[model samples]
Target chain A: MTDARDGAGTAAPPSAREAYRDLLPALMRADDRLYCLDSDTGLFDRAAFAGVPDRYLNLGIAEHNLMGTAAGLAASGKIPFVTTMATFATTRALEAVKIDIAYPALPVRIVATHGGLAAGHLGPTHHALEDLAIMRMLPGFTVVVPGDARQAGEAVRQSVGLPGPVYIRLGRSATPDLDARAAGTGPSAGEPFEIGRAQWLRPPGDVALIAGGPHPVLAALRAADLLAAHGVRAAVLNLHTLRPLDADAVVAAAAGTAGVVTVEEHWRSGGLGGAVAETLAERAPARVARIGMPAAFAERVGGQDDLLGWYGITSGAIVAAALNLISGTPGGGTDDPDLSRV
Target chain B: MAGRAPGAPGDPPAADLPAVAHRVREHIVGMCAGPEGGHLGGSMSLVEILTVLYFAVMRIDPRRPAAPDRDILVLSKGHGAICLYAVLAERGFFPVAELAGYARPGGRLMGHPVRAVPGVEMPTGSLGHGLALTNGFALARRDRRCFTVLGDGELQEGSVWEAAMASAALGLGNLTAVVDRNALQITGPTEDAIGLEPLADRWRAFGWTVREVDGHDLGALHRALTQAETDGAPEAGRAGRERPVVVIARTVKGRGLPSVEGKVRGHYARLSERQAERSLAVLRARRRRAAP
Candidate 1:
């Protein structure tokens, strides 16, 4: 029996990895220039991968080598999709990502799996709570954290067409499907989903919850529903892209809402929370509350939900933060510190 | 067709290799002794290897440095960047006069090689990255050949070994790496700093076809590098072979200039105008001695 949390034989929504597996055949047929650098993490089924021997390369367990190889391939006119665990790539092969991929602005899509705490009970070592912040720091890098397998798939496809290096953060678990929900009324799904653009899951209201990554966006959607039951009006914005952050969306959300709450499965200092705060502070100053992890390392290990709950990144926490902001008394909405600042 | 026999009609002459190396070394020495004090020992030792690649072995058009099929070289020991820049200039990838702007404010010649330099395939100064990069080029197009030069000291970096293993595993016969096995590093002798004595065995164990050669010996380097390009991957283009070749090039830290040759002091110097004059004189004497 594999724990849904430990990333083996789990029944979650189709993840970015599965989406990639589905999209790869059509993508290969469409463009023969595409290549994959699997870090030998069993990212794809052996049969599907074997059919395209010349287009794929297994870079073994060495993550930095994946980046280096991707650099060379990109230099040589091949579009490489370098895959690895987010923790290893963000922290372990960071220099390679910076020098080899980012510095050169290579058209390499770093589709990082096991992003955030998606590795769950495997503990902090497997978690990638800071991958987005690190990749966002790189100049000319496109940082994306898709909200569902569909959005994740869409982000990957969009990355292929977009120029330069792009880091697509993916969760290890099967997240609940939210694309259909995101595509309906609130912000109008008619707008073609584009990189650096945010999707609206709910209409404008007195308060808005801006979030990124699968878990956080789902939590924001659920939090919006809970807010509605309480007769509170809240808008949910799915911020898939972190760099070239949809500042226009952020500004509009701030302008319409009394206050804004930014949620993510990462540290409050530099992840999606920080990006929102930076945008709101400069573009539209509002009473902003950050719903993210504390500035501490993990000492407790449990399933993804327990870990997310322990860190106060939940629908309950986000709703509480929104209520507090609406009441003009923004403090720690969760068990941790009140990160809201006026 | 790229595999021209040594004395074939259209093949380039290896005789001028030493002369080209001598001139390139002169440029390197002058740059190192200027405002940009550099990795002098490593740069001087690399002249012959780079000369052979650019002049005698590599198939590149100076005007078309970015030709899709041109052979590529990555200098993994990036501290020795002036040597690569000097050679690129002589190869006509850029103007020889641009050498004057090296390390100058707003100059493209950074302390390390950057893509801004026309001929530089990839910017590298960080150790243990070039082999992996060369492997990438090899995998991208099996037809396009790639070479990288690594410092023996850089062998200590685990990333180099990772690339070595991957190259062999992927059967990248189009890729060849030359390790500039100069005994010393920035701190001191590599043995004293961190021993990589069983280096050849390590590469072999990592599944590479290792060849030992004198890095400073022009004829040996020309033969080794040329043979690697020509003999590389006949079956790879046909039946798929998994042997990536690595030439371990043993060299003195600074093989030219008598005063600094083999001396740790030769590793770096911001020579005063007078010292620069003296270094130029030594190169001139060597050129005079070898003149026809």
Candidate 2:
């Protein structure tokens, strides 16, 4: 019933995992019925919930029952946070997620960890590449893949208030906390974490870099800095929440900027790139590039960095895509086949 | 039409259930005689169970079905929705007029229970999910009882076992599940279709406190349910075992109207006008015999 999360020796920056472990117990105190259910993915500390053991039910390996139990708790007037790896939460328990949680509009927060290439060492079978696409198909489902652990914790805290099913995709890696600082690049970054709103780390310039998930957002910021050195002023918009998408920002970025490029660790077909492209195609058609893995299973990469590199979900890929769009040569080698019409 | 919110429902006249069930069966037969016939056998088999719960057992307020302290019921065997609808209307959850819209499009009443229907606690059509869901409801407000009626065939779903395991492990004594053990499924006899013998032992093995009862015997259903709600005292006893109850309600597929009684074809059929008249006449005869 335990995993590698309990054996961590990293002094990594306070992650969303840390924030949730610290803040969730407090939320539980505020609402007695705010129970925590895990699929035996002991990624978080159980001792942290020292006082309320009954409030925490480890559903072992049954992902379907984990979600269905959450729905039952919701129906019974308890707010339950169902946790599991992103792989099981979306695909393995899809029917439960759809019928039990989403269809009923239950107030259950799905705090899924190891999303996308974040589980890189675990290979494609563990990668939740299609989570966002699958979740978007459910009506009234709020999907958020925060840029960092801080945003993730903040999103989780905010999700408790929303009265419907909310899917919060967390990463295995605990990157530095998100800083909404005022001094950085294109746009100001100090936006409070909101469920439906998008946060911009840097403002729009010659081109805008729209990305989500922990690694991809950081990569886009790094790409923006690299684009600046090459005289291509690029902006980074952190689309933390996938559904109830910030279409207006996408449209504005398209209308104001020369071009736009999307980055994510997910497949190029239905990730942030697909969401942005679909929005832009209808609202404002513009030159765009999508930097992501092809519409296929990920390679058997050794580690997270290697997996990101193999799929071209790196800062270099984002910079290259932005530069291609900034110049007149859009749809460079970075464009996905799914984006041919876009 | 305004739904009359009456006082919390009280026990029925102990002697009147047979006649009451007879009338309820007549209503079921009339509704199924139309083009939109329902799962008549499943619903008919459950008439006494629903009658016992609504009239004598459950602490429900039809006027305010959402009362925080009221007992909740989920019909996991969704095919038998017409029977539930009939019981709910008789219990005054909605007006009798709503019965006409059963199985019709753009109406509140449907083949399966939706939250749109006032009395239904959770939407259930796909089997094996009800027990798990009801367990949550029980755990949330352990002070009240959460009951779910499931079909014998629904046990074939792994999700049923999933809920069964959780409910037992958690010792959710505030919850109870009534299995309509008619033995036959939509395809054929459940054992013939998918062997499920040793059913009682399987539930006990899963950690549930199991009980068997004559499902059509209204007095027996009333006794079993009354005993279930009295356990697991409160949240203060969370540390102790709060055993959830599962009542195996033995029944015949078609409980009355002998022409199709216990026959698989009664599962769903559009009764002809003549057949419907004869069925009503038979139920009325049973009513007269039970009345005096």
Number of clashing residue pairs in every model? 4, 7
Highest lDDT, which number?
1
lDDT of 1 by residue, B20-129 (tens): 78778778777876677777898988888898888887888776778898888899988879999888877777766677677888889998899989999888998888
Q: What is the TM-score of chain B in candidate 1?
A: 0.90
- Flag regions of model 1 displaced more than 4 Å: A1-12, A330-342, B1-15, B228-240
Estimate every model's Cα lDDT from 0 to 1: 0.80, 0.78
CA lDDT of A184 in candidate 1?
73
Per-residue error for A114 in candidate 2, Å, reads: 1.2
lDDT of 1 at B223: 75
